[model samples]
Target chain A: MSLTKHPSVGEFLAGCEEHVNPYRPARLALCPMAADAEISDVSTSDTAREGDFVILWGSYTQIFGIVLKHGEIANNRFGNFHHDEIIGRHFGSRVRSRRGGLWLALLRPSPEFITQSLTHRTQIVYHADISLLRALLDARPGHIICEAGTGSGSVSASLSRALRPNGKLYTFEFHEERQKQAMADFSTYGVLDVVVSQHRDVCNHGFGEELKGQVHGVFLDLPAPWAAVPHVTKCLVFGGKVVAFSPCVEQVDKTATELRRSGYFDVRMLETLATNWGVKRQDATKKKRRTEGTTGTTAAQEAEEEEPKDVPKTSGTGEQWLSYQMPMRSHTGYLLVATRAPDGD
Target chain B: MKAKPTLGSHVVLRDLEGAQKVFLLSSGANRQELRMGKYSAIPLETLLSCPYGAILRREADGGWQRVRHSIEVAEETVEVQENNQHLAQDNSAQSLSPSEVRDLKQKCSGSEVVEALASNSATFASKTKFAQEKYLKKKAQKHVQQVTLLRPSVMELCETYYKQSRNKVCGLRYDYLSSLLCQADVRSGARFLVLDCAAGLVAGAMAQQLAGLGEIYRLFRGSYPEKGLLELDLSESEKSCVRAIHLEALESSDPWSSEWLRLPEAPGDAEGEAIAPGRAEARLTRITKRHNDFKSLEAKAVDGLIVVAEDADLCAEVLELGLPRLSFGGRVCVFGHHLQPLAALQGAWRAGNFVDVRLTQLFTREFQALPLRTHPFMVADANLCEGFILCGSKVGEAEPQEAAGEDSPTKKQRRS
Candidate 1:
């Protein structure tokens, strides 16, 4: 069966109704370029048109770049691909290189894909931690969330998608260069409407006075998350959540103690490890022949002996697919989750 | 920001021993009672005045009281014996009899009862400081008649269900569910087709994350299973976004035909009793709505497809029927308890023009991050296999002849 036809970028954008938020400016005003060029939903778009960022995925490599500017070539080990060849193609298309006859899948940009391909400014959060963080923080539409020390903006991108359409993410980064790079990446990724990047140290200056008691959740990825515990207590609403990502158990101990001291209840710490499995199909004939050879019997003899009942009969196609866990990251960091106490307690 | 628990809504009550149960706070005539441990049932109405995270304790008079102070044990350097060598495991260590303890519980508060039990213990004073604290904490968990009221969210609901009744939710772990949501790129303002058989846990979670922004078509085989969805604290608008469609209706060639739209005859009409006009009208409206929801879903491609079935073959069948309805670049994720069934779908996905196929199993460990006690929680079956997730991205069609020949080279390269 042929693949289902998808709505074009223009049609999809036309179908979207603007949702106004009183806490922030109008959606178009946040990104002026979007007003003129119309920022496509990179996370859901099917076609990779001009000015859209896409992922060129090879067998063992992935290159992320913008499809704008004519004649811009994406050079990789696979081959060189012109931006002109990428535009007007549906995402997940296998396009052949101009000279090398090599092919790569052109994929639509998504937060998960971006996390795997983005340039690292600091230690980035992988999919495992990012997924758990969304659940722990209860990040959803119409909620205001605060994230500190936007190291590489990978987690910010993922969180921005979770808080899209009406929600906002106030992300603070201490380093100037990293903040600028993250802002540029956010703009490229078409999530500037949901993310507001600041170049200040939240651990020192706090998340501003206006945000006090307004945020629904706070996430700290700082070296000293306990230093910002007091600020989180002030900025979070009653019954709000705060999560701290620390690599060391000592950090978690200090952070948990500080959270308890600040009247936060139900403090929990967890680490998630994702095990990837490799699936391979085992041929039935090869296994049978190998077993026959080991038994010092010819194939014909083994076939005749099958009726004697000691030989095991392989079921189904005998070409069974098996999965085994591959080597994975043993440790990432500890996620400390706690809820703010109710008002007056 | 301070959203209090409303009447007729569900809230999770976590006891001191970390056991959680969801309770519906009904009002006036429909008020219910919550039974905790061996104590008497407490009226659910008493919890109406408490805030979301307020801790409630049972008083000596058998009334619930909100605890204003923190419940953490203060850390102080107490004069302690060198070790727990003086402590004995003999039954004589506790001087209080079972009948006497039961009597003390009727007259004293939970803390007072704990204090009396500790004082009657012969070896409690001779134990080290750490041992003494652990002993008191263990005793408190048993004697305390307290629970913290938590607002119901997807996280709390999933954890509560996984802990209390794993089979009810199809052994779906919260972390795996979270990974599924992320991998599928579930977000606001997107349309998703969900086929959830896990007591509506998956459907309810997507609705919670959508938060009144997107549309969810919950497909079911027979009667709808909405226990988990009803337990969530969703607004009227949010609940309205989730529409249930019968699987039979999807398979019908003409959903709007009269044959499909004809209402079922009312049962027990032996006396030719006339059906109520309002009830008939309601049934007609429901039938029309079901057909109309399917028609609208057929009108456009959905952004994502999520299937959590009891078996892998059913998951494969659903994916086959759902792949055509999924938009280009849309994600497809299937949940199963075993790997063989999930692995068997790899060929089907490859043939169906899906890319980036991955089979992932998550292993999570919870650590008790306390001073000098930082280690993974030591418990039997703490790391049970939650389940497996097989996910891929649907893409545009490839030339049939070239597609068959194009896969081998990449497979060989990846192998090398």
Candidate 2:
């Protein structure tokens, strides 16, 4: 083929190549940052207050920050930061706690920061599950993801971060209030720029099969997940991944049966658990010292030292102990991951 | 030939594509067929043995719907599996009527007769075999899954991050009052910035009358990646190119300080690129690298740089230094929770901040889409660990700011 003989068409093609996609109005929006915009800083001691912005860290070095607005503290894994020195700091300025702790002040808060923190009326997938689920599904940027029971929009928030700018999420929740909350939260988190929440119920009305195909992934967390399997099969792209989170085994069994019968391939049920840990100075006598100070010492120690009975040894010599396991969000729900079966036997 | 439809039989219908057609019976009806149809649909669900095969159908709309299939019927008893496993294992033999036995034996082939006899005596044996096979397949899948997750050592993780480090900063944030200890050994030489998501009240209280960190240096604001770009009217290729360029610009800019990476002073002996004759090549390279690292895509808004040029390097350094210094398990917290500004940032980057590039299968075309931030190393951990860590009274009691006296050090001085 002559390379340049078709000059006009070639030029037109080249011009077309340089053209940028027009802004999408339906499911997504693109918002550019200040050339000096930052990712926002997240750290200890400096709590991010309500109406403040913050970033979320995840596996694959994924970073998403959002500003806080409404919602209780239980929704986002990064509990609400209503007030803190780091709340309004610039990208590079240090966000240190009054306790003299240091923090990396990265990018500015995300638009969805508050949305991600909205309260969930239903059993919601917390932050840990969000990261793990994305990893398990190999969900990449620009992949279409589906979520049912948008519950405060937390999972949707994470999914929006995973699918941003070019990706779209069609989230469904039967509850109007929950949907409103989710939408508001998504707006707060900036994830609203790419998400759609509907007031339809998958179990009753069915997923919009005609409107959606090539759905890259699906997340189901509903009361009767089995009832939605038919719709799930209809909308799920071939070989697409679907994850169902349920707390009970019976639910898993029913859901599995439906999926298996529907010919969804490779469904595996699993769960996520995270334990809290405490880091403190370690010394041999740390335990003994804690016991001595708290218990006010024992006769054995006094006998060994041969100290006067009346002598009060207020100073416990046990090595300074600095460790304890804080309460952790140990159990959320069991996860069942399955793939849509390929065509033909 | 049509297989005889029996009551209480269970069946499923599918099209050639294997997609389930209408869940109907050989009788062609729903669960309420008994009331709707002249003849009630076979109640296959309750039957121990179903004689008819499922149906398949096509519709004018396009995809296949439900019809019916041909299946042979026999008196031979066939075992059933439930829950992908044997539901029962009954070995009791109940003699059938002589006439019924003869009918059963005559109906099936010799092998089927044996199968029927065996099924009657030990119901789950046949189903058990099928169940066991499925179980083995499941076990194999689990093993493969385990192998996939087989994690590398922390050093390996660090090295992976290092290899992917276009920008040398990792920020972490956590809840208030969670054990706030940073592990230097684990993050030595790494720019691990840490934040406490609880800074609002807890950190504010801890700061007391003293000026807080935010008060001292509030520079660049954070911008969140916006969702909903897939609805744009642009062609798939255009969307992708814009997305890639936007992402590149985002990465090239400093993630922490609202600035882009700057080339180190060339005079230093450290690894440095030579300055371009008239161009800030070194600086440009740094900028490009930062762009590459903070790759983002936006559709609705004007595309442009995220951070001001002057603040790029300073922000980058602060992010680089602070993140690593914080102990392992430490977290970083951002305060603003609004989405408008972040959405605006994404819009600008998409419209003007980036140069179009070549890409494929990157932009979502067919279905509702979402934007995802990809990094050379790995994605960020989305599990914000700070949410639940500060739940109890410890979070309530700390009040570090209120306790800290501006002029005095009343704080307990624990020897490190």
Candidate 3:
């Protein structure tokens, strides 16, 4: 893997030998800041070897790279990082450039890293939608699930993580190119076995007998979920669930009507709206403070509180908290969930 | 085969009358009947024996539709405007007396009753199709046989408490809680410290997110932790991940009081000294090991920290004990009812031990989605905790900025 001033991403990814799987997405799993863990401790059995898919994450930035032999260079705007420095080092080790002017940690790749940083082929599902669907569906370990219209493999990634250790996800994308692209991503992230992608119309041809009447959950991100309802009904087990993610109310209306006749009960439509706040530690309260104080996130508010005005300041006090701010996401879309009949068993 | 809704299982009970109550069903306990009024106290037993999430109805009625349509009816295209004024202008529209309608219900289903009641109306032939549909929709609510069993999710639990007793729960908005979980970076196999305000809503969710794989220390106030934790309906493994600690005890030099460690009193033996069963000994061993683990935990750091405490004193203790214990890059999340505490926290973080200091307040308004008329609900917001939160991450001292990709490569790269 030579350091080209402008190396193609595909070329770089093609040469990688292995990728990180069984990852916990939200938090970076391994780093020096993390507890001291060997490479084997952080990685699955099919761990990153020479040419494995590894990411070089700086304190604030990340670059996907190949795990190659000594003397090869991974050069970016930052500097030239020699392959020799990280080839024998552990996955979570912090390595510096040849001159030691810059530093980055050799870290494993997560699905989120692939989703947020990878190139997209279509409008993908958001993390909020994915997690909410997982929660609403009560996807448990060993629950086999089906997903249609795997647009950009965004939902596929989270599903792969959510049903880990035992479960598997059978995902389908109608378009050949997109399905092939998703397959590439699954391989890139080392989750090929966990998520099975197919290039077929699940609505026209029901999920073959391997999945017929046995899936724990089904997610439809298609245009006409009503058209797919019958196929999904045949695939879902007793008390299984189907969630149709439609942007339009009219689609939900048709889907609901079909589900009413499809022997599914307790069908309801919901819209997921998630909000993220900033929570941080302030300096420890320096004094026994007064009881009542108005709260605001303005300069004047902080300046107004020079002292508690009633209590004396002290040394060696602990930290305070600030819990005010705006959210990271707004409404995603309306989600409709319906359960198959319990008596069907 | 799956087990029925057991004593410890969290169940959302929908009585025959159609009111839903969410709670943990205890066996052989005198309690409010699931079907209400004269339904007997065996509600819990019956519910446990039945299938989980099965609707339990008091009475069964699969009646019929008897419509008198002897007269020839012409097909008419009649569209009704909403709340047609002319229909409401006149009175005395029904030929059947009230008792006659009740008699009809005894012999017919709600749809049948709607048909009979409509056919006998004085203005039945004069009304529009939409009006008739609306009338039938309203009538169905009164007669539909529905029940609720187990929808033990965070959303259902939040709504149940928010409507019943707002103060009894933390009142954290559903989406806001989800976002907090995401920001806290809560995941399986991640060690965390959680301080619950009142209802253990946050604490319970964290246990689920961890899925019993990691350690979870739950800090509570008063003598015991939140009773709402029962709402989580934790299995044996999920419950094992949770440890409830008195927040006040953290201030004491020996946080582990003797009370926390005292084994359950051994049953009296008249003739000989009784050795504790292996189960009891294992429980003691777990408690003792956890005690020592907590002692050692004070010396190291965890993956993340979450604080939902509203008490000013408790908030301070949570931060004092939680912030330093977070490893670098670990998330710190605080959810409260007001904005002041969160804002004050953001200001304090100007010292820059942390980065990505974010503050957010989330309020959600639901919309009624009908075929033609879709609008915001009259009550725009649910009775929710004035959900204000702040989340950020531990960062080592700030790194020097990279201007852009435009910057020339380092000199060392050329030689290499």
Which is the leading candidate under DockQ?
1
TM-score of 3: 0.71
Among all windows of 10 consecutive residues in model 2 chain A, the one with the lowest summed lDDT is: A1-10
- Stretches of candidate 2 off by over 4 Å are A1-28, A31-117, A280-322, A343-345, B1-416
Q: Looking at model 1, what is the TM-score of chain A?
A: 0.80
Can you write out model 2's per-residue Cα lDDT over B40-138, one digit (the tens) per residue?
Answer: 233334221322222322222222223322111111135443453534435343345557656864454333444444445433344444443433344
TM-score of 2: 0.41
Q: What's every prediction's RMSD, in angstroms?
A: 5.7, 21.4, 10.5
CA deviation > 4 Å runs, candidate 1: A1-46, A60-67, A286-318, B69-81, B253-273, B347-352, B404-409, B412-416
Native interface contacts kept by each candidate, as a fraction: 0.47, 0.00, 0.10
Q: What does the lDDT come to for candidate 1?
A: 0.75
After TM-score superposition, the amount by which residue B229's alpha carbon in candidate 3 deviates from its true location, in angstroms, is: 4.1
Docking class of 2: incorrect
lDDT by residue for model 1 (B242-328), tens: 888666666666655545455556644652247676776687788778766776677666778998877655565566567767766
Top-down lDDT ranking: 1, 3, 2
